[model samples]
Target: MDATKRPLRIPPQFATYAQKHELFELYRRLIARLLMEKPEDPLTFMLEELKREDDDVPAIVIQGPPASGKTTIGKMVSAKLRTAHITPQILLEDDVSPLAAKGRAIIDKNQSIPMELWVQLIQARLKLFDCIKKGWVMEGFPENREQGLALQQVGISPKHFVILDAPDTVLIERQMGKRVDPQTGDVYHTTFDYPSNSEVEKRLVEPPEGCTEAEMTQRLVLYHRHIDGLRRCYHKFTKVINADQPKADVFSQVITALSSKHRSLAPHIPRIVLLGPTGCGKSVQAALLANKYDVISVSSGQLVKEAIANESKTGEAIKPYVNRDMPVPDNLVLKLIEDRLSQIDCVTRGWVLRGFPRTREQAENLDTAGYEPNRVFYLDVPNDSVYERLTLRMTDPVTGIIYHTLYNPPHSNQIKERCQRHPEDSDDAVQKRLAAYNAYVEELSDYYQTGLHINADQDPHTVFEFVESMLVSQLPTNLDRD
Candidate 1:
């Protein structure tokens, strides 16, 4: 993590005995050029480095004054975004009103915690997490300029900073309105959420002297002093939301801002939709394209199945139809697919969607969700080819690697021996899937005005060559690689 101590570049040397003069000169020039290269910005370098290492995880930071809704907003954003949420309070001492207020005197008077102590807390807390890998949404750390610099020093630059802004009056009202259940850590607000009975509520507690107007004014002063400088530091990635608005409106603004910022990180990544029949090698091509292009491959069916397995709300709603061998309603399916595709992984890494948009309605929904693909690939293989490939197909369940008994086989028998065969690889199941795809394939294709139609009956290499070449020609040169 040290920004200093860049690796030493050993100078090139030539042996006296029988050295090729041209090669020696080339080596000397290369070494000199290496020495002349300017040093890199370590923070920028580390940002790229971690994205490559943890493509699926997105690290986020939410910053605001004490009562600007950082905690509530952080929690909601984390759930909607499906990323880890960490509050620095937990990084402080175990049990207190605000965990960050350890030596309570300074903080109790609406003053800043020591810069060194705050930085140390962040460092220790981060060490316990694989934040680089799974990503994180952090709240209430980096309370001021120095702490933000400390974060930079540690090579942790967030993808986005959500900065909530509100008037002093609004923040004061929020602070006064909110109450906490220390036993369960459940927070309630006077207007948004309240106890059933004021007197009968055994759980309620009176506000401390800190709830008074004078104390609130001091807290506001402490809060504003810190945020203005922090905002200046993170202006490029900061989205200022008005916390004075209604709760739902504020939340909606936060979601839109965060989502837009995340997408902005990856400008034009050749977002693609692979549409074809079940046995037309859609999954195979999706995987091949993802690997060659260094992007993500998502299977819509698998996403739906996963939702079902997790018993999500969407899954619960779609359970009856899916069980009855009918397609899950477009609304539920589209929501699930939209959530998956909008994740940080897809935004930054790029993505190829499979088994999605089987019908015109679903395709329209995908467009509504802002998934207008750079190109829609329709693999046009004959019915005979489809059946032939399906009958011979076997999958390694552990790896989800598709193999055709006649066309493609495991190179080593040892691997072939251990592969878990999927139960649905049976011919009956394959026919059912193929029949379902055939019924609606025409309508799906008609949904798009233009598309790349490949004769998938050809060998895999030839088809992939055409598809990749078309993508290369269409996408900017900046794309075609991560």
Candidate 2:
């Protein structure tokens, strides 16, 4: 049977779009008539067309943050086009034992295939030229500039690059909520929007020991490199979909882009998440992380505030506790966290978790509930320093900006009236608060032994340097000393 000249089978659902264009309308009517009167003949004609040389199956590339539904979308798109879904990860995994036997260090301790493994996998996949003649949807390959170039060297160029853009806040929240099956590596997230079978909970896997901030950053850097390559080479053939929007809306935009005949450019979308503590300059640090990472910050406190304003059940439960300087119930806090994480934009990128897990019990709840941190940073400010800093705290009534009267006073002291008034009995209250804070720190120090501690009394830039140093030290290297 001929492969290239096969008769087209336009689904009934797409009949409307086909009717809107003259060329498509004629083709659609002809196909519909043939299907009704001469089904055998139409199949035979399509087989002939399949054999013809002019028809080429379209190629679509889907890219997005981890757990952003890229794989699911890839599968759906491939099914719609009646093409093979080729994921490089699958290819590499199939060949891992053989590749490793040949001295190819293909697998990391995380059991993920390395870059070289991808190169080998791509080379092997490309050998199936005849099989891919009908085209295939390639997912999870060309992870960086080098890999992309490698694919180009092997004469494989995708027709379109579909970039799924989502906010990092969404990504982080999603990631924190994500659970993978240890046995089969199936990924699942807890959400009403993406419901999973109750049995899926049994498959949750624990992350490997020593999964540190440095390790997470290394993976991110690799992702960045690959994304950069996609932007550089396929910039013209790119279609960016904001995955932060409603799933249906995002899918519609994707379908529209894929059905279009010509390639079009899409805007670059950034995802960011901010993480820090209360009154330890987490907000300021979040801004720094946002600027450095080129993504937006998702503030947990802000989310809680919004929830409280909306009088969400969980928020309402937390309101009295927070107002009375008491910790909310673990289940209530978890509900709040879960709700915030389910938002489309929160789990897409790096994010900060501010004003969360203030107590050891809360932190333990986070771990038990499966919200692990790639890194935990402690701002090690002395009690005296914190006292001095809080003593001068002031708020701008108009802009809601926080200022320090000692170091960052308002212009000409015009807003001095807005300075936070210390309690007449503040001396005792401050001492009590300091004692509680110290106790919390002592427990935190014990809990996260590997946590990076930055001196908060220093200049902000200097503290950032310490952060960068910690990150650099965490990179994958054979050096014994960290």
- Model 2: weakest 10-residue lDDT segment is 263-272
In model 1, which runs have C-alpha deviations exceeding 4 angstroms? 1-53, 94-113, 196-201, 206-209, 261-482
Off by over 4 Å in 2: 1-278, 294-300, 323-325, 396-403, 417-430, 472-474, 479-482
Residue-level lDDT for 313 in candidate 1: 88
Taking all chains together, each candidate's TM-score versus the true structure is 0.43, 0.41
Give the per-residue lDDT digits (tens) of candidate 1, residues 90-154.
65543543435563556678876677766656655555546655567898877788788777765
lDDT scores for all predictions? 0.71, 0.60
Clashes of each: 0, 37
TM-score result, candidate 1: 0.43
Give per-model CA RMSD.
23.0, 24.7
